[model samples]
Target: MTIKKKSRVTSLAAGRPPTARKPKSISRKATKALINTHHVLEKKKAQAIAKGDRAAEIAIESEIDALGGIEKYQLASLQGQRLDRGGDSSHILMEWLNSMDSTISSSAGAHLKMLEVGALSTKNACSASGFFDVERIDLNSQSDGILQQDFMKRPLPKDDSERFDIISLSLVLNFVPDAMGRGAMLLRTLDFLKQPDTQYSSGLRTFFPSLFMVLPAPCVTNSRYMNESHLETIMNALGYVKAQSKITHKLVYHLWVRKSGVQCPPATFKKTELRPGHSRNNFAVVLSGSSG
Candidate 1:
């Protein structure tokens, strides 16, 4: 019996489980390959976004560059000499002028006389008007020739029938303190163009055939009276229709037309607003003599 019991114990000990072995080390090359693949994908994504942003930025910068840079206000004075001897052609101005009706001639009349309101000291006004016989009316002056409150308040010009074929109002409207005042100013300006002794009299009544206005882009403002939409709305109310619109650089430009006898078409805002960084404001309207 003792011998049988000892043999049973030895069999039980032999049936015990074996110990577990340690895992093998990961290969350095395999680990590095996994990390590199992940990094490359992340880098590609970053580059794509950066490229997109850069393209947008370049588009805006190009417009501004075309406007002769931020020192554009100085353009007139710098090019003043050229103005007296006839100025160079501007791509922006030519493009704007050409976009008008096809019947209109690109050349100004032999003795074209122009009155530029809010004339920045730049050749832009001259270049846009095809270098017409231009007279820079300095609003900054206080003398008789300078624009006065009386002129703004008075009846339209009595003389000068069909005096000017084209009139440009660039960067002038915003200087007005409020919308109502600006509207009033616009009306008064039209009055200057009104035909003498006619019910349909407005500035350009017998003076100009077309008018162009350039303004800043719309943005948040502290002054409710000076918003962009208000200005545009006022213009529409006065029978002006947008003939052309463009955004170059960050600037916004619009051209409107008022024919002598015919009513203007309904106003429609152009969908092409200036982007944050365009380089120029290339906008224009042409009214052929035959359109009337």
Candidate 2:
């Protein structure tokens, strides 16, 4: 006789399903902690927006403070002191002022020609009206008629035989994708500004002897390739020397002089230092043609 073993019955077999594990409940303290963390993150984001919104105001206030408040201005006026006097940039301003004093000429009659690369609103605004016969050349195809025309297609006028006293390439180098490309573009700019005689002349010569390059300051571009040293190196390689340098709010203005007769000293590195009896922070560099 064959005997069949009885099957063991589970809770499911008995019409009661096995008890499922329940999720652990969060404590009130943990819930509050999570809420607090979320709030902190939101607060930080708000603070960042506030900071960004007030950045310009902060910068202006800082500048005024550096200038020694209202008393400094009073003293400056009393002493007949020009605020920007002895700043290496006086030469450029003097040249511009001298030009302005002369008879006003048509945009065509102006002796000095200017080629502004990467034409932006700031460059356009700072540009002297009737100051050096100005011609704007932008690379963006969309900027047609806004400037004279795009530089890539309509090359600078070959017939007009005037050389620019100053050629400005402002705040545009960092946008170049690579160093080789940037170098090529820089060379091209130099080539365009260069006088035709230099192209055929025997001696080592340049097209436009004066170049004002306003590069992105330490604060402007995030790219490693774009910096003060890099720009100086490029200019030096192209046979230009730093004639003047000033650290303004948004940019590093460098007035470069092509192998001119005047040999200026190299730029000196000066750490801003606070001293006793000094009205404000002072930079220690001795201004000369060459960098110290």
For model 1, the run of ten residues with the poorest summed lDDT:
283-292
RMSD of each: 30.1, 24.0
- Residue range 1-292, candidate 2, lDDT tens digits: 9999986766553653432322234444553344334333333434444578566545555555565443333233222212233222223433443443433333234355666665533223335444555666654322343364544455544643644556776645543433343455555554455432333222222223567765435422333223456556546655577766777653566667665232234332222222333233111212222321
Residue 106 CA displacement from its true place in model 2, Å: 17
Clashes of each: 22, 10
Native-to-model Cα distance after best TM-score fit, residue 189 in candidate 1, in Å: 2.2
lDDT string for model 1 (1-292, tens) is: 3555444535543654532222233344443343334333333434444578766556555554554432332333234324443332233345665444232343333344455565444345454555455544543432234343232544445576544544566655544433334445555455444332333223223323445665545421222223455445545556566666665543466666554332355233322433333433222111221211
Rate residue 233 of model 2 by lDDT: 58
What's the lDDT for all of these models? 0.44, 0.45
- lDDT of candidate 1 at residue 292, scale 0 to 100: 18
lDDT of 2: 0.45
- What's the CA error at residue 50 for candidate 1, in Å? 50
